[model samples]
Target: MTTLDSGERRRGSDTRPLITELIDEGTVESIAQEAWISLVGEDEVLVPLPGGPATDPVSSWVDVVGPWTGSVVLTTGRRTAEELTRALLREHSPAVLEEEDVADAFGEIANVVGGNVKAALPGPSGLSLPDVGSAPALRNPADLCRVELQWRGEPVSISVQGALPPLPAPR
Candidate 1:
């Protein structure tokens, strides 16, 4: 049997699809809605309306790597995040919420949303643990899939953006 050439066996240049190509606003909204209902409250509904930019914004995200690599980010106002924590904890919530409570709840939300987003993408992927704080800078605008939503009159945005910068131009 003849040996195959290495060049012939090499994978074609950057065949991976962008986040926008793989996911849409509606799919992302649906995923967020399900997460809200399950984690925040059964009665809570994420209105698919742009409530404008968030005030005192805080973000939580989880990285996904595989056929596609990116971060699934959730951003909302600090007050809204605190409220979400309260909603999540229900009777377990203290009258005065702590920073740690907000972080844990918000991080959990990102984990749930990110997990679903990862599942929807092409398989054999790995998801990183959730992180809370500032949102990661968007690397490639074209590689982003975002959805704007309102929860209890608060603006929230979910963005799935590539972690790596755009590939260099072809020679």
Candidate 2:
């Protein structure tokens, strides 16, 4: 009879790499910039300066499951989200934006950004459907790679954070 390890032998040790180890802030910023230009519009640029805290904040995110599992979250104020929706929709935007409109548009943006982020990571990953609401609580701070930027003068932040807490130190 042949016996398989079943990954039990390494259970006490976690060799998984952190987000910081896999991707950097500048790469994330560049990804966002590309997504912005492609989806938001060529004229729309994400300035790499912090625009301060957001009021009436909302967040959209998608989960990535693979060697490094986590969420790619995009957060900004509700008003800014609406503006983003309009920018995304352009002339197709409704005269009065609805909650569903915001959710769909914002979720799509998260999808695009999340997709690009996933591609940059080590592959064989799966992405979850985008969700819009409050951002997920940070689990392992050391596994986070975040970037803050201004879009149309509003504060927007992108956080690529790991979903798991720090593993117990190897004995």
For 1-171, candidate 2 gives per-residue lDDT tens digits of: 999888866773557899999999999999999999998999999999998889999999999999999999999999999999999999999999999999999999999999999999998999999999999999999999999999989999999999999987866
Give candidate 1's error at residue 4 in angstroms: 14
Off by over 4 Å in 2: 1-13
Stretches of model 1 off by over 4 angstroms after superposition: 1-11
Give the per-residue lDDT digits (tens) of candidate 1, residues 42-145: 89999999889999999999999998999999999999999999999999999899899999999999999999999999989999999999999999888999
How good is model 1 by TM-score?
0.91
Clashes of each: 0, 0
lDDT of 1: 0.92
